[model samples]
Target: MIFEFLLLVAIILAIAAVEVKDMLYAVLILGGLDLVVAVLFYLMAAPDIAITQIVVTAVFGTFIYVVAVNRTGRKEVIE
Candidate 1:
């Protein structure tokens, strides 16, 4: 049941990350998704992989995205 809940949350976060208009919000949502995936990995008995996922993806990935968005702007350019 917990696994299912995390999966659902991850799916929702993925969709929200894509749908959000602001780049910062999207990056935050993607970070949340990464965290959820890490938790799923932990539950699946892959602690090493889960730790790597949290450190590499959730932390570094989000930092890179935030830096890129900061260099650019938060608003999406639809033109």
Candidate 2:
């Protein structure tokens, strides 16, 4: 039950992330999604993979994305 809920929340966060116009907010949301995935991995008995995912996606991935967005200017292209 809890696992399903977490996944649902992650899915909702993913949608919210995509729907959000602000790049920074989207990046943050993705970080949350990555965190949920890490928890899921840990629950699945993959501690090593969970740790790797946390370091790679939850941490560095969001940082790199924010850096890139900051370098490029965070502007929503409304066409």
CA lDDT of each prediction against the hidden true structure: 0.95, 0.92
How much is 44 displaced in model 1, in angstroms?
0.3
* Poorly placed runs, candidate 1 (over 4 Å): none
> What C-alpha lDDT, on a 0 to 100 scale, does residue 72 get in candidate 1?
94
Clashing pairs in 2: none
What TM-score against the true fold does each predicted structure earn? 0.96, 0.94
- Model 1: which ten-residue window has the lowest total lDDT? 22-31
Per-residue lDDT tens digits of candidate 1, residues 7-73? 9999999999999998998999999899999999999999999999999999999999999999999
Highest-lDDT candidate: 1
Q: What's the lDDT for residue 55 in model 1?
A: 99
Q: Residue 69 in candidate 2 has what lDDT?
A: 95
Please report the TM-score between candidate 2 and the true structure.
Answer: 0.94
